[model samples]
Target: MTSVGIDFGTTNSVVAHFAAGSPAVLSSDEPPADWAGLGFDRVLPTVFGRGLDDRPIFGWQAKQRPGSLAAVKRLLRAEERAEVDGIEYSVEEIATLIFGHLKRSGAAQGVGFDQAVVTIPANSRGIARYRTKLAAGMAGVQVQALINEPTAAAMSYSMRSATEETLMVVDWGGGTLDVTILRNVEGVFMEQASKGIQKLGGLDFDSALARLVLDTVSDSDRWTQDERTGFRLDVERAKIQLSELEEVSVPLPGGQYRRITRPMYEQVIQSQVHRVREPIEQCLKDLGGSASDIDALVLVGGTCKTPLIRRFVADAVGLSPAPGIDPMTAVAEGAAVASAILGGDLDDRDFFVSTEHALGTKVLNPNVGLVFSELIPRNHKLPARATETFTPVRDFQDQLQVEVVEGDPEKPLDDDDNVVLKEWTITLPEPRAFGEISIDLTYSYDVDGILHVHGEDSLGNVVLDEAVSYGASVDKRELTRIAQRVSRTLDEDRIAGPPGPSASSLSAADRQLVNDVQAKILPFIDDAEATQLRSAVTRLEGGDASAAAELQAATRQYSYLL
Candidate 1:
């Protein structure tokens, strides 16, 4: 089986693989002509929008579709089920769609991959990580390992860097800011400390620019959804342009423009720049080493390309980031490096992986009467096992149920709707009075970060060990079904070649329809009413006349939110 590495990002996703003893990033050979504005060849945006068939359109095809779900990686942690075309798709299912896209894109380049090493943020909690695993399975691929984003990047750095050095990676990406301190010791990437702000990243910078653009416009609330999308796209493009040039102009809807100089852009985002400095300071503290201890500074993520960010990082870390690293694709490339290690294609040193979350079980507290008992702490090296024995309350316990959770055992999930990561109830073959029996709860966190638990009756010699079933998660049988279904779907895609223009793509006639509908609906609907309008536009692309009906009904529904 060919080994690949997938970097499923918050904004853009990519895949890399080891080919003929060398690692390389993969892109599409010829994207379908119909997917004109979508699928940008090298990077696939983590976006999905409702299509003409009502199934969600993905990748670049979803880009022009108003209300397309972008920044979905960040949103996955907050959501469980999404209403997609009136059919609810679990976050894992949504992620699977993107993964399938990557897999197919790689397949197009003649690589038949059955295994991969996927990377996630270092600070990803249990549920999010679980969903990612399910997603890979859903895409019909076996995940060799789920590595940390920075850790994977460190692997890539180790290959190119000739000397052993204490390195710091400031991963300022679209969804989060992760600061990792590690070392390249004799070709092994050793992690020292990992710290991150999950919610802070390029989106904030875009929002800042968006706010400035909105300020420039009069009666911004009356702007159409297309206008809003146009403005956001322009801001993002100009932000990239400002990196290379001193100034760039953002074209407004009505032939107007918002001129942005690099200095002005820096001024607007200075607060964010200052905010990023916190993690670096904290990373140093965690490492118990000064900035001088960092022999090399490496920048990853597209946001790091900005001059302001580069300058801030230099000042914060007291060293310039080493050149020759391509910030945009380094994480994915590093993932390829890690994938090589797992596939046994390359073995320079042993790679030690760790858990991203703490694993523990809930029980009665001695003082509080009811509390959570932690079995293991976060970042504990994988293939680790923790065993502890506890006594039941009564003479012979008929059965015992223990709620195993991630994070601090003392702390429950912030949301009441969210449940503990794992919970199990083991029944004794014979009814034993509570106090007489001892329950040995053993937790084995495997190399993949999967938690396995077993309860053994010390005297009875009966043990029940099973995989923890979390909410909306599939069992092994269901995983097989999903894998089969995904395999069939991907095979069809491979046979069909590239898809043509989708319902999500906006045509010239569709623009006319949007204009006509917006005029009729805006008087009653004060907001852009993005979803309904986009869906209506999708319907029109599918040859539905009187799309105005969709706009009118949607306008009424959206007006309440205003």
Candidate 2:
């Protein structure tokens, strides 16, 4: 059996195998026939649908269904839930459906994979990762490891390069943007840190263009709700066209249409482009590295194929982006290379993986109040272990709370932020006195990067020996419930009504007043894009007070859409 590597992406997924000498992509029985013909041989859509019997039909077959939800990537949130034809599925189930397709595809290629490596965004949280692992388990594949996508891309790039150098891998995939700084130190790849914007990607840019098309129709009073939705779909096509052509004509209802220039599309998407840049700036700052210090800026992902994206990156990074590597398969290829290394099949070629952050407990001290004594330090090598002593504040204290936290100590304090407290309130019994120093907390990370926290007192008593897995935080089933409630709430609000009439919808006198304000604001609006101007107009026209609040939440959840 051969070891396989999978890049289970949001928009599309691919699998690869290492044979003879280099990693090669496998082929899938799906559309985009070229997916199976190129050097990166295998690629498949990640969409999956449930049948009446609750059995999932995956890949192109699932996507071919009428009204099929094609972008299952956005639905991967731990808190997202969906019901298709009265059958509910968690993000993990959908992922499993896709994985099953890959498994069958691999089997079709005459390769039975036992051990496999998977790629994920570097900044994926514990829950997202746990769900990914569960999805792999459902597919019946033994996950040899879960490597960061950019790290894998860096490794793949490093392997082809002659000189050892530090490079920044900008992985702007269909649904996510991840920026990683890596050092190829004498052939050992070491990842510094990675930052990501989950909602910033090709989809958001498409949506922005869609909105611009919708605005033109709305202005003409020719847009029905259905027509608006159709325009949204047309916008995606127009975006693809504008990417290739300087200008493209997007057809509207009644045989009428508007020509959109690349500059116009860029104007619509400028905000999203800025959103992608912000994270890269933060990632570089966090790494304490300069753009000048980076030996190269390597772009990976289908979205990176855009000329505007390439130009922006080249301008921002002070270096021309690399060429010749297939953005879509680079990460998957890098993952195969890493799998080869772990299987003891590859030589000393460096690629970076994010440092394993330690999970430790904080104890209450009489003199110090609460002090964090780390059992495992951040960036500790994987499959590693460390033990630490925790003394009770009181001599006979029977229990201690082991607050497991993951993050840099230097992060700003925010009382409302949950990221500040990654995990807390894991308790362990203290078997002896304070002077006796009764409990020992041991933290270890496995090959898959899942954490396990174990504790025992001075008497060799085990207080807790449980896996600190993602599913433990919340039931996977509840995620769908939360999502349903959230979706319903949003729909209800949308149907309730707009706050007031717009200037175009107002009386002539009122319109004049609105126009006076508009005259004052139009210059700023012209300088700003349509979306931002629309927001300002909505607020000025006394739109719902909750609009800003709702927008803020959406912005945080999908900041890439800004």
Candidate 3:
């Protein structure tokens, strides 16, 4: 049986299989052409609906229904429950709906696999990843491993190259932007450091452009509710056009309009770009290296296809970006390659997989409410094990709680933030003094990075035994039924489709701002080649303003245009 690799993205998802001789992206029941033009053979919309019959409908079909939620990924971490037509769902339930669709699609393809690997964001913690696995399980797929997105991309790159070199993988996906530095030493690609920002990605750029449009055209008194909504939609379209063309004109109400220039788009999204760069810089600094040290800068993810993103990455890494590879497909392709390797079909000589961080628990003081001992340190190799001892807070205390946490303590709530008291169990023991040690907390991370917490008191008594669970869980069958029913009802109430190209999508004022940006950036785009223009557009449309500013600064190589 072939092992499957799945990239469950926020905006889209794809499944690939390694069979026969090489990896192939699978085709869905949906036509291949219907898939997102950015390239995957099976690009399914990450949207699912609850129909009146309570059966979940997924992909483009689900989106066709009225009020069907398109961006469920945004609600994954939301404390508030998501509801459509009186049916409520948690993130895990939403994931189950999507996974259920994938399962059906795989069955239709007649490819059965026992083990599968799923890709996740670099910054996701053990609990979030575990929840993903659970969701997959509910869909009837057994997850064999959880791989980081950038690592998967690197694996794919290594499969294509024979020479060993250090490379930086900049993955600008729809909902997240991740940067990873890895060294391919003698064919083994080892990650030195990885970092990312949660809020930066393509969607932000769309919103930014929309806001710019609204600001330009609508007056506080004249703007109707419908117009405001329409402008937002138009702004998204304009952003798409700006990615492909030099300038895009959006029509507005009141006989007024605005033209969004490529340069102006870049200015509009400069802050977003800069946000993406901060992590890259931090990764480099952590690795004790500089941009010049990298042999190549690899860009991956749908958002990276934008010209601006490519240019920003190339300029940041001090080298021209690689050609011929589709950034969006790279991660899935790499994941497929890794699946092949794990199945023992591909030569292991080309690449090696190792855990880049250690998993551990901290010993906390009940009385002081402070962490006193460190059990695990970052960057420890995988399949790792570590243990620590803790003393009782009071004399003759009968019970103790073993709190398992993640990440480094020194940084304090950083991107690498640690999860405190994730899982704990009460232990009963004989009376002991405050200074007398009572329990030993041993934290172990399996090959797949799932954390298992084991505790034993001074008497060698096992206290808490279950593996730590993260995130909420829902009844799959019930959720699917509710989603289906809600979806059907929503379709009945639909009078018109989602907001179209109107002043609501982008206002006249926003168009003027885009024009202003064009006046500043058009000369640069005009002088730059097609490749340069594409990179600039990617950076601009990817919606990281800070990254855009960096691209502007780094592209000073074309300073003559300025």
- The CA root-mean-square deviation of candidate 1, after full C-alpha superposition on the true structure, stands at 16.5
Off by over 4 Å in 3: 29-41, 51-54, 64-66, 73-80, 110-114, 217-234, 250-258, 349-374, 413-418, 421-425, 429-437, 471-562
The candidate with the higher TM-score, 1 or 2, is 1
Q: TM-score of the candidate numbered 3?
A: 0.75
TM-score of 1: 0.77
The residue pairs found clashing in candidate 2 are 26-42, 187-350, 189-350, 189-351
**lDDT by residue for model 3 (1-562), tens:** 5768888887678888877765667764362232234354467767777666866677766654554566666555333356754577666667755766676677678875534788877766666566677566545455767787888888777767757788888888878888888788775666678777765777888777877766775473576645554555456557766777899887675656898898988888877886777888888988888988888778887778777877877777788876656666677777777777776777663443333333455544576556525565555555678877767777778776655666655644323355553745475655666775577777887655667677787777776554555433233344334334333432321111122122322345434433434443343343433355446445545553433443443332222111
lDDT per model, in order? Answer: 0.70, 0.64, 0.64
Across 182-246, the per-residue lDDT of candidate 1 in tens digits comes to 77778777677776777778788988887876776787677788887777777877777778889
TM-scores of all candidate predictions against the true structure: 0.77, 0.71, 0.75
lDDT sort, best first: 1, 2, 3
Q: What would the TM-score be for candidate 2 when compared with the true structure?
A: 0.71
